[model samples]
Target: MRARYGCVCFAVPKKLIQHLADRSGDEGHKQMLQAQITQSAAMRGTRASKTVAGVATNAGAKPLQRSVFDAAGQTFLPGKLLRDEDDPAGRDKDANEAYDNLGIALQFFSSVMGRNSVDNKGMRVDASVHYGFHFANAMWTGEQMVVGDGDGRAVKNLSGSLGILAHEFCHGVSQHLVPGGLGVVQVAGMPPALKGEAGALNESFSDVFASMIKQWHAGQDVKAADWLLGEDIFTPREGRAVRSLKEPGNTKLTWREDDQIRDYRQYKATDDAHRGSGIPNYAFYTAAAELEGKSWETLGQVWLKGFDQLRARSTFLDAAHATLNVAATLHGKGSGTHNAVKAGWKKVNVLA
Candidate 1:
């Protein structure tokens, strides 16, 4: 029987208790137990019982929406996928495009490196499309990756290129790869924002991996790698390409104003321009380029290993150190891999 407050039914007769008390001299213990029962009853009498959100309802549960595609795996909220207006053939928005890109990204990770999934633990990948009306950007929101069909002028298709998807999915990979993992509570010694940098590294790694996939697929020399994410995704509305790997500020776009079309050229800066990624984006490209040959085969492995081994809230320096350690451990202290990683950071003034 359930206790009323702290009172439990004593099935034993009072004569049985008297016999036990005489044998054990436990009268004080019995009295204490009786007192506890009385106090518990007092507390319970003051308590209230009520139903909340129905007995079996989970109305407050945070649901995760998941979707799997050929290029990558993504989870996202409802009403995310949007149409791509920039397709010259007007076929980019086809759902199959998302499926195809997801396939490519997943295959690149598994087939290229012999890895299973982003976390290597097989966490479900999530993707969302048509985020926000005519949104101009795509992002991996830590939980799921979301893509936007650009304004038909700046960015045309969401799934036309594998690198773009890879970049976003890499965020998931990085979240799992970090030491403490994502959404961890802040410890006394660590800064919360530093933990967020793992997301950035995730994006950076995706770009690196995407470029590697392109090079591997094309069978191109590392030096000759195009490093461009979407070569054909941009429309004449934006005179320039989606983003340039070799040059940051030099991509030009053409916009129409008052029925008169004018070509505007821009370089990436701190301002809100896609071109601004040129600085750090190029740093990653430069690092990989400096370590030529099959990137996933060597340089990519180094970065992956480093990212996986470091803490969740790593800095650029932490990444540099991890890369250096991996290089020295795998190659040697002064090997070309070591020197190249060092030089790559030096070029960006990120390291000595």
Candidate 2:
């Protein structure tokens, strides 16, 4: 079958990696990081016109089927199968983390959202861990998920980061949720890419849902939640998390090189998807924090359902409106959740 879309959703932003590479004093380490960026681009191009296997939502399959594989320090995807959903946890720490985290995400989405796996129709979730040599990224490549063992010093074991895993998984969800792929743009001679405001929505939705999953799994409310993405993936020396919904551009809460912007006023058409997502990330945070309860409840559902109606070329304002409509529909027009949703967009200056 043709690719559902060619856009690859990566956990680590290219800009951040570039920043790290640029600042690295060791030429060898810098070259290693730069090579990753090159390989990632090549991977995207490889998948530009074709889909990878292992993402079919067959009928009568397990309600939530999953499998884990070991990339064994290679770029090959979904490499040697290490464990299946029915198998016991393997000794490989990265493989086990991938399997367990995927299960957690499946449970949350299934039990709470009533969605069956990534495709919402029992599509199997396949993951590959330990991808590449010191590769500091994770991604959903249209068909399956791939994770890398980050350089031990700066970016560490991405598979161990539940937020990172969940964030990438949500990319699959978005690919399946939004018809034609969320914010996917196809130029005459370019691979289908996620760009502009729609691209930001894609990244923001990943971050928002990842945050919701993190909070829900920890049994924490919005107030109690750390609201950090990829907290476990980074060392204290490099940074805390990848991004913070609590504060988009606040490097102290996230990392030193985070270029995310919370206000729409700061957005540019050329901003990377991760950086541009900050506006909506803060919008979701604003609404959820005000709701003062578990994020996956009404607010989270409203946000998810709102994105459900979006197309490939949606904008931040488009997303804000969709979520607002969902909130008003699920909760009464003037309900607290509805007001919160409205206020979230207005606060981000998207609605205003």
Candidate 3:
């Protein structure tokens, strides 16, 4: 059997697709856009089934290896190696953005968390930009990151957004660090009963780290940070973000109807990973707010340590326990850090 890993996508949601479809002036154009979205969705599903090939694993002592490829609006993997680590920035804005953001993400893992690279062993980071014509999505394909330039009407080029790039890259990190690779469905060894919860954790970890990296890059403290994911990519009128950690269910800023849930009691077992991730995302935000410092300082370390300790089939309750234990270990048994972790989980009903 082939070793399988999760594919993380930053795709425009179905709701937004519907909204865009409604707003499209030409009926034929609307149908075409909808069809394109459908095709992208189908492509994602297919990619999920494919096994990881050619991508190197964490190995040896090497500096950061960054590569940016230009797909030039074609649906192919690693189209042309446009830039490597030795090359200076060129004219393509999308490629430049992808390369620079990859560096930022790589730096965060290396400097803040003391991780060598995405896999903690210097795995090369590679990205492909301008994938497909108005592809309307971006994804980490278990091997490399593929970014799309969205349909000009509804969405913008995804590679231009740092948050989205970081989010996808973090998925690569989670796949390497976590057991069973954080897939949406239960991988071979994961407990069947915990599949949904595992999926939620997969997304929650990505969003949490993504926010942390963005904050770190912006030099924002926990209190000052917006705690939003994909804010740059989404138009303000369309929505503020893909998800908001600070205010989980409040959409006043974003106008997104399906707001995130703050408490575990609000969790829907049937909800997809992105929707279900709100619970843990809010829990992280609450913990960061309670700690009241740079998010990457204490809360980030705790979460990173917790990710290392997470079980293959870990659920929200498991995460709460792991993070709380990590906090105590790192910040003293009954210190404020430990208390903050406990309180944050309690707010989300993960703990009493």
Error of 1 at 40 (Å): 52
What would the per-residue lDDT of candidate 1 be over residues 6-45, giving only the tens digit for each residue? 1111111122223223333355644533443343234223
TM-score of each: 0.60, 0.95, 0.90
lDDT (tens digit, per residue) of candidate 2 on 1-352: 2346654677888888887888788999999999988888777756633233554434527766888888899877667888877888879988988888998888889998889888887877888888889989998888788888997668888888889999989998988888888778776666667888988998998999988888989999998999999888877777888899999989988888888998888788998888889999999999988788788988878988999999988888888889888998889898999999888888988988
lDDT of 3 by residue, 1-352 (tens): 2225435455455655666677768797588678876775555444433223444434435667788888888877777778877689998999999999989899899989999767777877778999887777787876788898877755788887878888888888887787666644633553221146777888888889989999999999998899887777765556666778888757765445755677788787777677778888888988888889898998899999987888666888989989988998889988999988888889989898
**Superior candidate under TM-score, 1 versus 3:** 3
TM-score, prediction 2: 0.95
Query: What is residue 167's positional error in candidate 3, in angstroms?
Result: 0.7
The TM-score-based order of candidates, best leading, equals 2, 3, 1
The model with the greatest TM-score is 2
lDDT of 2 at 280: 93
How far out, in Å, is residue 289 in model 1?
A: 2.9
lDDT winner among the candidates?
2
Clashing pairs in 3: none
CA lDDT of each candidate? 0.49, 0.84, 0.77
